[model samples]
Target: MEIRHFRYFLAVAKHRNFSRAAAQLGIAPPTLTRQIQDMESDLGTRLFLRLQREVSLTDAGRALQAEAELTVRQFEAAQLNAQRAGRGETGHIELGYVASAVFSGVLQKQVSSFRLRYPDIGFTISENLMPVLPGLIEEGRLDVGYIRSPMHLPEALSTISLLVEGFALALPGSSWLCRLKEINAAHLQNEIFILPEQISGTLQVAAQGGYAPTLGPQPGGLVAVVALVSLGQGVAVVPESMVDHIKLPNVVYRRIQDCQPSSFLSLVYRRFEKAPAVARFIEHVKDFSERPTL
Candidate 1:
């Protein structure tokens, strides 16, 4: 039966007077009577017994009334939630970040802006490399990953360039690289370089000077890299995000000149089947960025 039929029957049953119910519904008396008649006919039962302008609900009307009220309430609730989701209000976002974001503030700012706009959406963050993250995102275990560029994005994956931050030579406070106001590629040729194990682009860039320096690929994690450099184990090329953290007590950071390759950063998401909330969050980020202000 039509929803209006339920509304009409309930109003008439509640008022117990055809004229009063018709007026309350802002419908003509004859029209209200026809609607009630139609509902009773459709249900194959007498919903109301009319007598001298007074009405009383039949057995079926009472039974249907209880269920109809619940249906209407549930419908209203569903509509409210849909609206909230559309406005990017209620949902959850699983985000992944590589080591660079840990030092650079760009990722944090993007997330902060998104949270401010969509406060109801919870944030779940993961810090990992693309070799592992790509599979997780494709499997729906992750919503998005902040990964380094030069990725082999499959057809099942999509991405938007987030930032292209150049690598700087990060060193110990007393190291000689820190003393150079401007670092030339040749300066790094003889120093031990600490780069992430999964970063091919970083290795390629540092190789431009053809240093063939000692390979200090610290596979453990960012902390290990910093610790190694602080103790003068070797020099590594790190992104700016690492600087955002409290500087490693004895570590120094400086930009490199005549670098072979640039550092490219991107937000990676599974293509074609991303959750709706993920798209909404990305759009908010793009909008806020173009607003001409930080």
Candidate 2:
């Protein structure tokens, strides 16, 4: 009827001696006897042949033992599985990110540290940008994200400022901008800038500075942006880390000399949605944030 019954039944079945089973279980012999009797009564069968000094399983007792062993094993497995999730030992976290996030380092570093701290908590990463996230986060499809800041965050969600990524020009090594220790909007006054249809990295910074930047070529995503810059189509204003991935054969990265503005990025999480696994994963991330060793 219950897991305890199977445990008792197994102990009794193993010993084939009531007194010995009681001794092994650390329960009084009479208590053990009563429990076995109750189990037999509930099952509508006698589990053992009771002799003054000997016991042996009946046909029904062996049948019950096999099924009872499985039930006990299942309970134990379920219990351990739940504990694993609570301790961040097993389970998964779903995360979303926009491209410029790689440069921010905040989310990336936190994730690396969290993985080391809770290796059993598997990770599912998705590349979901800002424009389409209102439905994702609200519908509980996305657990957490690194997204553009200064937008209207969804209601019942939380955000924490993590990094400030500013615009830096990437140009051909022979381009004049590379001659300066730094470059800025003024430096590009007469130069063409390659822009992405999803020019998230530079657009956010440019908007805060003034007007949208005039475009020379339109690309999509960071890779496209880098490819355009490498082709000498036009210089691109991109996050610093984009260069890390797209080391061009003839391109140079220069800091914006007259930094009109910068873009802010933050880690966003659903508010008040508590799951044991999610909480543990975030704690690992928060601990990493406090001490950024990654």
Candidate 3:
């Protein structure tokens, strides 16, 4: 009839005596007897054969015993899982990111730390363009995103700046500029610049050179932009961290002597996040950022 009824039946079945079962259940023998009688009436079957000293299970009681044990175990397991989810100990997070986030190592460091703290929380990570990450988070398709800043964001999303670094020039290995001991903005005045999703760094470099850059095709990701440079299609200005992580054939990274434009790797999430797992991750990011050292 009810979960408690199943539990009472199980205890009585285990001990084979109503008095002992009642003692184990912290209830009087008469109350336990009445509850078992009520269960038998509801089921319309006699579950036990009562003798002068002890009780023995009927055919129906044996049939119900296994099912009752399974039900009680499953019910208790469900309650435990619910409590863990409420505490942000077990759930899944949908995470999106740009290529630079991985290049900077901020994503790996922060995620690894969070995993160590909440091992039961799972993650589904994906890489997306910078422009779409905010939209994904806003639309509830993604729980959080790692992206580069200096771009427009939706009103419903908020970002936490995680790492700040300058830009570097990605050039064809055979370019004459690579031969220069120190390349300045003036030397890149007439070069065609392959643009990545975030163009602010390239624009900043051109603005400092006192001339408009010869803008080229805008690619989707950093790897594609660097690949174009490897083929001698054009040069690119990318996050300084890329110099260390993105090593493609025929593409050389050079520091610009004249201008130092900053790029930010940030974590973006919904302003009002409802999922406890996602909220816990955002809090972990905030805590990781405030630490004196990573």
Candidate 4:
């Protein structure tokens, strides 16, 4: 008839006395009797045999008892899970990122800190191109993204700048420029530039050098661009953090003396995020960014 009826039946079954069950349930004995009677009437079967001193379960009552107990426990568990999800204590988040975010270590630090605080929250992490990350978040395919800054994003998406880093030149170790005590933008005027996902750093270097860069292969990720430079295909301008993280053979990193172009590693997500776990992650990143040590 109702969940309360099942509860009343359980209490009575446990005590084998209406007076004791009513006391445990904090209801009048007559009310508990009527509730049990309602359940029997709804099911078209007598669930208990009432004796002068105590009550005993019928064959139908024994079967119903097991099912009712399971149903009540499942219902209570469902309610608990829903409350935890609403509080951002447990849920799954789909995260996307570019290679530079991992190279900078900002992604790992923030994720590790958040995981320590909310261990029940799960993650599905993926690596994606810079331009594709924002679109994935906007399309609801991804909950959050870590990407480089100075790029266009969909109107529905927003970003928080996490790390600001300068660019470095990845050149062939045997190249003649490596012999120079200090290299500057002016010296790379005629050199071919291997392009990564973002070309702003290279363009900035060329602008300062007073020459239009000879743009070379449009290879995609940071590692691939560095791989091309290792083979002497062309030099690349990449985030300075890559100097420590990427150690491809035959590729050497040099700072451009005359120009320092900055690249930002940012966290991107929907402007109006609905998932509590994703929103909590965004807040955690914001807190991490504002710390003085960062």
Candidate 5:
């Protein structure tokens, strides 16, 4: 009837003697005998035949024994799986990122290292614009996020700076900005600064460098912004890491000289998270950030 009944049946079947079976079960022989009798009464079938010195299994007893063994094994396996999931050893983790995170290469390296360490954990990654990533994390659409700074983070979200990098101007290959060896805010005074439709961290960087840059059309994302820059539509300042993502031959990235404003790559997650996997991932990111980099 209950799992204990199956256990009693198995112990008796294994030992064959009531006294020995009860001893293995840490119970008295009389207790074991009564339990077996109760199980048989509940099942409406005799499970064992009592011989002169030992007990032998009847046909029904053998069948029930086989089924009980499998059932117990499966139940134990289920319990173990639940525990592992609770411990964050096995579960799904969704990670969202801005384009700069990928360009920085830290996000990819951190993910690879985490996967190697926690192979049982499942992961999914999404590349989103800076403005949406924090909301995605807060709304539970993403477990964690990576984004560039000048972020207006909600109270529910927490962040850690992974790296600090300077901004670089993405220029048209034939533009005069590319010809200047050392660029300053003065050089960009008359330039049209292409900005993404979403939140622009570069605006803060430009502000810090004392430039009231002329605004260009707001494109969809950094990729499109750079594409527009390649067409000589305008120039754009982005984190240095993002230059790696700019593959357009028509665009050249130049570092700002004299007064370049720096930007930070930060990892963001929800506060008071209940998922152990999310906590583990946050810890991994922190640890990765602490290590020395060349």
Candidate 6:
């Protein structure tokens, strides 16, 4: 009839004596007997054969015993899973990121470390262009995202800067500018700019050089943009870390001199994300961002 009734019935069945079972359950023997009697009445079947001072199970009782044990175990397991979810130790998160985040290696390091710390927490990550990432977070399709700074974020979303970096000039290896020790903004005045669709920092730096440079079609990321540059399409200014992941034999990275453009990554998420797992991940990232060498 109820969970307590099943428990009482099992206790009586285990000890084979109402008095001993009641003592084990910390309840009065009469109370235990009444509860069992109520269960038998609800099921419309006699569960036990009561002798002078002993009890034995009936055929129906044996069947109920097996089902009851499994049910109780399953119920306990469900409770434990719920508790784990509440603590943010077990759940799912959908993370979105720009391709440049991988270039820095900090994103991968933080994710791997978080996995080691919270193995039960599950998540999937997707690489998206900066323009689409904020929309994904706002629409609830993505729990969080990493994007370039100075985005026109939605009112419902918030962001935190992960790291600040400087820009590097990506040029064709055969280009004459590669011969320079450090490139100054003045040097880029005559160069064609191969820009990623979301590269506002690069655009700004190029503008400061007094060049209303010709803009190429929006290449998706630094990798693609660099590939275009390697073809002698145009020069690209990208995050300094892009050199780490997009190393091409025909492409060379040069530090920007005289005019150092600010480059940084930011984490974006809904201001009121309901998932405990997302909160845990955000907190973990905050701790990672505060590290000295990140």
Q: For residue 116, what is the lDDT in candidate 4?
A: 100
lDDT of 1 at 176: 74
Clashing pairs in 1: 103-241, 103-242, 104-241, 194-236
RMSD of 4: 1.7
Error of 3 at 14 (Å): 1.9
User: Candidate 3 vs candidate 6: which has greater lDDT?
Assistant: 3
Model 3 agreement with the true structure over 131-235: per-residue lDDT tens digits = 888998999999999989977899998989888889999999999999999999989998999999989999999999989999999889998999999999999
Tens digit of lDDT per residue, candidate 6, span 1-294?
777787888898899999999999999999999998888898999999999999999999998999998887888899899999998989999999998888887679888999999999988988998888899899999999988887699999998888787877888998889888777888887788888755776677767887776677567877789899889888888888877778876898887777788767888989987788999999998888888873
Worst 10 residues of 6 by lDDT: 197-206
RMSD of each: 3.9, 3.6, 1.8, 1.7, 2.0, 1.9
Q: What is the full ranking by TM-score, best candidate first? A: 4, 3, 6, 5, 2, 1
lDDT for model 6, please. Answer: 0.86
What TM-score fits each model? 0.76, 0.79, 0.93, 0.94, 0.92, 0.92
lDDT of 6 at 94: 95
lDDT of 1 by residue, 161-244 (tens): 766676666688898777677887777777777766445545765577775667876654666777888888787776666666
lDDT of 5 by residue, 14-88 (tens): 989999989988998999899999998989999999999999999999998889999888888998999988988
lDDT of model 5, residue 55? 98
Task: Show the colliding residue pairs in model 2.
Answer: 183-257
Query: Candidate 4, TM-score vs. the true structure?
Result: 0.94
Question: What does candidate 2 score on TM?
Answer: 0.79
Alpha carbon lDDT of each predicted model:
0.76, 0.74, 0.93, 0.93, 0.84, 0.86
Give the Å shift of residue 133 in candidate 3.
1.5
Tens-digit per-residue lDDT, 1-294, candidate 2: 778878888998998898899899899999998999999888898999988887999999988888888899999999998888776578878888887777556667778877887777877888875666645866789778777675677688887676765666788877877777656565565567787434565564465456666678665566777777777777887766566766768778877755644567767777775776677766665665566535
Instruction: Point to the candidate with the largest TM-score.
Output: 4
